[model samples]
Target: MYSRISTVALLARALSDQAESYDYLLAGAGTAGLVIACRLSENPKVSVLVIESGPDVRNDGVVTSGNFSFTGANDRVLSYRAGKAVGGRSIVNGMVYIRGEQAQFDAFEKLGDSEWNWDSLFSYGKKGERFEGPDTAQKTAGVTANPADHGTNGSLTTWKSIGVNPVTDINGGNPHGFVSAPQTLDRDKIRRSSSAAAYYKPVDSRPNLKVIQGNMKRIIWANEKKNRAVASGFYAKEEKLGVKVKSAMPGVGENMQDHNAMVIGYGTANTLVGDTPFATLVTAQDALGNKMPVLAASSRSQISTWAQAASTYTGGAIDAKTYEKRFQIQHDLIFKQNVTIAELFPTNLGSAIVSQLWTTHPFSWSSVHLKSLVSFDDPVIDPNIFSLQFDIDMLVAVARKEQKAYSTPPLSTFVAPNQVLPTNATDEQWTAYVQANAGNTLHVVDTCAMLPLDLGGIVDSKLKVYGTSNMRVVDASVIPVELTGHTTGPLYAVAEKAADIINNDS
Candidate 1:
């Protein structure tokens, strides 16, 4: 073992000695990369190297503050935020940890990814989490839990929000009603518990694992046959540090998706105050109740229409039948399985409840493409938000329902006599407002989707890139479908499962 003082130098010498190849080369030292590296490095026989674009931010106060800000790509159209440090977005995101609806995972299984499902992923979810059950104060506040769904021995720590009742286990495949879920935080320290803190920090002394800071230029394909390209390695450049490195990985960067969100702030007269901004959340069906069936039926046809458009957009990369099958799975999750169509974050803002709304699934697809093969340029990102009319319509309906909720009973009594954001705004106006003000939740996934190659999938169920050897994508990019919950929980589960898969394969 190398001492703390000599570790960096030793790591540099090791990298210099083994510059040509590594047992495993990870493109980004973010959430997925860190988890995989730590897990793989457990075996002293394997050599692991992780290349990150950002600096070592393990002790940076600003990055570890648990507060969020939009970085990377911020524009009028889309304000995209992605953490550039070792922990990635986990360091900056709202720490709400939800396992997502069972139906959403089932949809992934139905997409011909047999290995993916609720039960299987749920086990992985537990594998990566260490649940900090409710304390005395929290228990009195109504926070209950199912011990079976929680893990006692895991890397990440989860804690219940104070003064909130845990109606049901959100991980028990049903999160319909109001429930107090866990957050990825160090309750004792009151600080963010990111993947880097939980996974990387523990194993930083491992001699086999080496993490280098540099921006990935592109995947160097050994064979570029358009359809049968094989990955050899990647080129990276860090100008500030005057460092450049080339490492191997064919499936470096591909398939990208993000959660699109819009906030509907409502001013009220109630003096609601709480340290936690939002501790309670309700699914769309729970919020809409009996009036959901009609709207669900009306939206069914749009699935096929979207599939057709998606197929055309891909230039037949995915067949019409495949596209329809993929979209139909999503349709079932939303309508039949009752997956969350929209999420509402009711923040008690002194004199208002800024009801943030987020659409669970959007038909739009975007990409992160390299501008050139040789240059270390930033990847061109196009988050085609509101490309589909259905997304806009769904958001509009969510806004309308939120308005209705504000006007009802106990909630209405707290509201100010006057309405904010025009309570009686027409459908046209709401739609226009959503279009102009909506932004992404930074929960991006599915760029290098894990589906069969015939269905436009970049990676397989095992996360291996389809036409290559020794290249895998174990990040949010492999998620085939958009999920109802935040990306952190699912991604932790994915990385845990990915480690097992890789170990088993080896």
Candidate 2:
């Protein structure tokens, strides 16, 4: 019977043939799930199965950062904007690689001294990073060589942008005055090609490793006398595959949440020269056969590139020399100067820059829950985005700060003397403008939080679900607290640590 079945057959058959039984069944091969799957399958003795809710992203242009021109959503592979894709949001993520501030991790310890404290978790963070990019710049900017800060050897490839238009000055300092964005991309600058590419691809050849494509609706529960569930699996629907429970093991889908975001757009007079368009800069390239200036990018990368475009078009000057002078002045007049430091990204056209001011650390909370028992349905995501008043107040403050930054001395002469969004120019006017155009940060987290049992937590200190024996939640959903920087880096670290935990336990 085994000989009759081809290797091209279903994962169920492959899994059945490989081992008498597999040790783990991972669901939702998103950013975190894939990491866990690969690590657990590393053992020659253990067998693992990874059930993805979307299709394969092998050559999908939309999922590959190299194909920056393909702006349309890839419904076939990634589950972005409600599409059933395999790579999950990583397929369409901004790919902004950032670590949580030391204080943020320390704060978690203060909040109860859980296993995820800065001291205990730092090693895991180091294990997940694969830092690349120019060493001098990364070091001078406090990016590399700081063993206390950065990780050199890890699975997820993190580095400064390559193929990036040179914005540097003669001194070779950062052209934009700030550190280059550490992106969650490969050495090639491809987005969505995360640990999945590094771990899953190679390991897929292993006899014990099985990766399947399907939707994940909910956890199938196996009761043990009482109503309390004992074991679990995924409930999914496929056209030819039909409805089935691929996972013999169980997982809990209880805890869920996401970070809130708001973007600010500023207008420019000319077609400003920047990286691409929008606040979230993922990928950008000049139009083929024409350098006159046309950008193609995913929505996430558009934000920063668009902002840079705005800067160039509106004539907001930025270069190494200018920023260096500004930095020097600010350093000398530390307290004296009213500095409003912020992040900026350039777009391709160089016409307009969408100045995005996200709250970064939102005080409000929300969650994602299952809509029904069936697989292939979207989850009920109630992010309650922008519900908190503090978030709004922060955005307003940031707007005022941006206005002042552009209005300051040397910079003022270069940048236009008017507000691009609210022409009238007041805090109130800025707030109104922001309210109408602000959007999400896409850093969703905290539904399946790892907290102490007394704190209404879903997972334990080790990331194992509280009620279940073998079940664990390792994605961003399990993060108890929001980080100061973007979530991708920290999440990768969490997944790496989770892998160690699962491997040791198994």
**Best by the lDDT measure:** 1
Name model 2 segments beyond 4 Å from true.
Answer: 1-20, 66-84, 135-148, 154-177, 187-192, 216-229, 232-257, 267-348, 409-424
The sequence of per-residue lDDT tens digits that candidate 2 reaches over residues 1-506 is 00001112232422342322445677767777777777776777766767676787756666676333211011122122532455555566666665554445654554453666666666776675666654563345343223335567610111122211322220111122233455656644544555566556767788888777754444545554243334445434333333344222111232233433444444555554424322221111111113112311222233344334323422442322322332233222211221111233332334544445444443334445556544336676554444434345455554554455445543344345544554347667655655565555566665555655544456777776655555677777677656544666777778888788777775
CA shift of 152, model 1, Å:
2.0
Cα deviation of 69 in candidate 2 (Å)? Answer: 9.8
Q: Clashing pairs in model 1? A: 142-165, 233-248, 234-247, 254-447, 255-447, 255-448, 256-447
Give each model a TM-score.
0.83, 0.67
Summarize candidate 1's per-residue lDDT along 25-140 as a digit string, tens digits.
Answer: 77777887788888889999877778777778889887566554232113365656677888877877888787777888877777778788988888888987788887886666
* Candidate 1 segments whose C-alpha is farther than 4 A from its true place: 1-21, 68-76, 154-166, 218-234, 237-256, 268-273, 277-294, 348-352, 374-377, 412-419
What TM-score number comes out for model 1? 0.83
